[model samples]
Target: MNLTEQVLHVLDNALSLQGRTAGFTRDTPLLGALPELDSMAVLALLTGLENHFGITFSDDDLRGTVFATVGSLSALVEQGLARQDP
Candidate 1:
């Protein structure tokens, strides 16, 4: 699956969104827009992403801008993977 689909799936499962994430697009606001995206949800999302992508996230890496939009979050994942190359 593409990044968006993968992200949506992760969000759906992590938040128990009940498929509500189907309506999300690249423009979907996440950081401050969704009430469900509070501190706990942010931690859940971070853990889910680390597990799903098999990557690590330092506390310094968890910036609000990274989770601003679906596209931005996906791009951050892609960038993280890219950095893993030898």
Candidate 2:
């Protein structure tokens, strides 16, 4: 899967969305928009993304705006992938 699809997969798995993410798009709002995305879920999602991508996130890498939309999160993942490139 591509980065965006991978992100949606990680998010669906992390949040236990039961395939609800099938309709999600890059522009889809998360953070305050998704009822399933509470604080704990955020942690799970972060961990899931980190594990899946084999990239560690520093404190400075996180911000509320990063979770504002699926596109933003996908962009974060893209950056992480770029950082790990040889």
Each candidate's TM vs. the true structure? 0.90, 0.96
lDDT of each: 0.84, 0.95
lDDT (tens digit, per residue) of candidate 1 on 1-86: 88779888888787778998899998888888888888899889878987898888777777889889888888778877777878
Count backbone clashes in candidate 2: 0
In order of listing, the candidates' clash counts read 0, 0
Tens-digit per-residue lDDT, 25-78, candidate 2: 999999999999999999999999999999988888899999999999998888
Model 2 residue 74 CA deviation (Å) reads: 0.5
Q: What is the lDDT of residue 40 in candidate 2?
A: 95
Q: Pairing residues by index, what is the TM-score of model 2? A: 0.96
Among these predictions, the greatest lDDT belongs to 2
Give residue 61's error in model 1 in angstroms. Answer: 2.0
Candidate 2 clash pair list = none
lDDT of 1: 0.84
